[model samples]
Target: MKTQDQAAQGKVALVGAGPGDPELLTLKAVKAIFRADVLLVDDLVNPDILDHARFGARIIHVGKRGGCQSTPQEFIERLMIAEARAGHFVVRLKGGDPFIFGRGGEERAHLLDAGIEVDIINGISSGLAAPSSIGIPLTHRDWSQGAVFVTGHGKTADANPDWDALAKLGMTLVIYMGVARCREIQQALLAGGKPASTPVAVVHAATSGSQAQLITTLGDLPAALTESRLASPSIIVIGDVVRCASQDLFHRLTAEPDRIAG
Candidate 1:
């Protein structure tokens, strides 16, 4: 437990910057950023969002991007601890929702262990914003009963998500950081009994000005991705819900003729 004096002295806020769009930030998150004495930002966070920071607020970029050199996790934790100990309100601004694959849980645990006060502000996850940006609902009553948000990359090869089990769930699967391993993931899902014809949509930089997307089938995902050249920081949405994407986006891919009401 944090002592009253410790809590009053300093604190840290795990603020989600939302997807890529600066306007997507929640009101409370805006307030947190404006009041922050120091901000530790993630690589994926939109730079425009920083406009909300109060003038003269110290901003530190601690980017963590896959397949690229990133700030060490241990170092980031120590910095937050140090800043908070100095009686500064530290904001760990991250892209998307902090709790959803953002490593917020790990950070929270470390802060508590160090007796530092921590609070989390929710942001819209890219998984949700990405699909919605192009009019693809993750779940639909006539098609999907639920949605599953999963990471495409595992901490270790052996620790990867059970793609087979996930396929068997029959729920909408929204994969993050899976763009790099598209081929492997496609094979796993196919082997897990998912049909080759399953609709899939890969949205890159969802809700951002440079947003782009490709709609394809599970079997064609790898090839389509190669041909489309869409890269990481993308969301792969798999299921019939992908078929519900806006008509404009549907033109680029060969989709089944209107199966369900849009």
Candidate 2:
């Protein structure tokens, strides 16, 4: 019995586009995009996702691209604030899970401060999705129990990741924005007494057609990754779980004679 007028009041939804794969999007997120009156998105988000917006909504691009002059975060928040104030439902879309370096926290705080009704729609993060697609488990009783997600691409002033702790902890290490620092990080971990032969898996353009998963050892990770010509938006995973993905894929690929070379 709700009136159409009552339903038209503005609301804001922060949506996660997932790590470049449209298939990885959650159903709720898909529904929210389709319902949006205005969609504000980031550059990392894949283009295919826009097909889900069935409402013929206005799509606004306010994304922060790597190495580019990013549109100020405060400006993006104000855009959301201004649009929602006009009584249009706005969707702030980001690539990957919103909470994981997606900058959703800032926007959330801004909207709430302005007294706008807001909600977050979670999506798959590349951290876990990339490895899983390559058939790696993050934890194993026999290998390692903890999994650490770190950002390796940001400013040195903010944090050059704690190489010392990561080296000693037996956790599965998942690093984002790692391409730039791959060599340095690998060397640091190697210097910290982490086995030079420890397995490492680098997933590039994960969960998409351009995807490539390369398995190598920590010592050779830098060379292997560089040789493969993989680009940004990739993830680097180190630990025994690297073997898990390789073994799983090997068994599966080996089991299928059709896939094997004659």
Query: Of the candidates shown, which would achieve the greatest TM-score relative to the real structure?
Result: 1
TM-score of each: 0.94, 0.87
Instruction: Compute the lDDT of residue 250 as modeled in candidate 2.
Output: 45
For candidate 1, the per-residue lDDT at 100 reads 94
Off by over 4 Å in 2: 1-9, 248-262
> Candidate 2: global Cα-lDDT?
0.82
Q: Write model 2 residue lDDT over 71-121, tens digit each, in one string.
A: 888888888888887889899999888888787887788889887889999
Predictions: Cα RMSD each: 3.3, 5.1
Residue by residue across 13-115, what tens digits does model 1's lDDT show? 9999999999899999999999999999999999999999999999999988878999999999999999898899999999999999999999999999988
lDDT, candidate 1, at 104: 100
* Alpha carbon deviation, residue 16, candidate 2 (Å): 0.9
Best by lDDT: 1
Clashing pairs in 2: none
